[model samples]
Target: MTQVALTISAEADLIRVRQVLRARCQRVGLGLVDETKLITAGSELARNILTHAVGSRGGVRVEDVARSGRQGVKATFFDEGPGIPDVDQALVDGFSTSGSQGIGLPGSKRLVDEMTITTEVGSGTVVEIVKWRRDRSWRP
Candidate 1:
């Protein structure tokens, strides 16, 4: 169940993307706190796509997934920029290429149930995350 898919090309786009993620998550039974986490995580990833990717060229896709009897929301942020030179270092807290607090990557990870990163130095990056609904599990 792909709930939201859209292009994020600027700061303005980021706001809309986060709003959609929040609304979709809430509509799908995610509690307020869970919705905030999802939106926050999505915001960080989406911001990275804009800040690091070329021309802020990227897109976001959020979907509803029920796997292994667990229900969750999945969000993927992809960009065709100069890929992350060091995925490991980037994931480390306090590491920022753009010179900020550097909590975006690691903090986003903490907000989600699972996260995976795929990137190539000269190519691009794709970050996917999932947040499960612990109060209820999906059967079938």
Candidate 2:
């Protein structure tokens, strides 16, 4: 697996995240659908990082994984925020403590092949998502 990691801060980083993901998708020859999904998912996670993290910054890491003649991208977000008090409730559709769009987490998960999150009550959060290339034989 190959990994790309970065610290996320300011609104500009939001756009940067999408750009980086799109570039990686292109580098790995991912299709438009896959690229779009990565962009959307990246945006959502970045939004959450900005909104909830407050004074702290977050990190986003993207990795390339190969298996079974297929390639997948894994994106992970780490934040030093107040963290989710209730993971189950936060993941449920239409349930948001911040009360914004409430679609960031759930929507992001729907766009990826796998999604996992972990958080501490007073520490921070880590969200990881993976998207597999559409073509099984695809490679960079």
Clashes of each: 0, 0
- If scored against the real structure, what TM-score would every candidate get? 0.92, 0.93
lDDT of 1 at 66: 81
Give lDDT for model 1: 0.85
Question: Model 1 compared with the native: what TM-score?
Answer: 0.92
Candidate 2 wrong stretches, greater than 4 Å: none
Candidate 1: residue 16 Cα off by (Å): 1.3
TM-score of 2: 0.93
**Top of the candidates by TM-score:** 2
Computed on alpha carbons, the lDDT of every model, listed in order, comes to: 0.85, 0.85
Q: Kindly report which residue stretches of model 1 are placed more than 4 angstroms away from their true locations once superposed.
A: 137-140
| Model 1 lDDT per residue over 1-140, tens place | 54678898888988988888887777567878888998999998988888888574699888888877667789889988899999889989999989998999999999999999999887889999998877674243
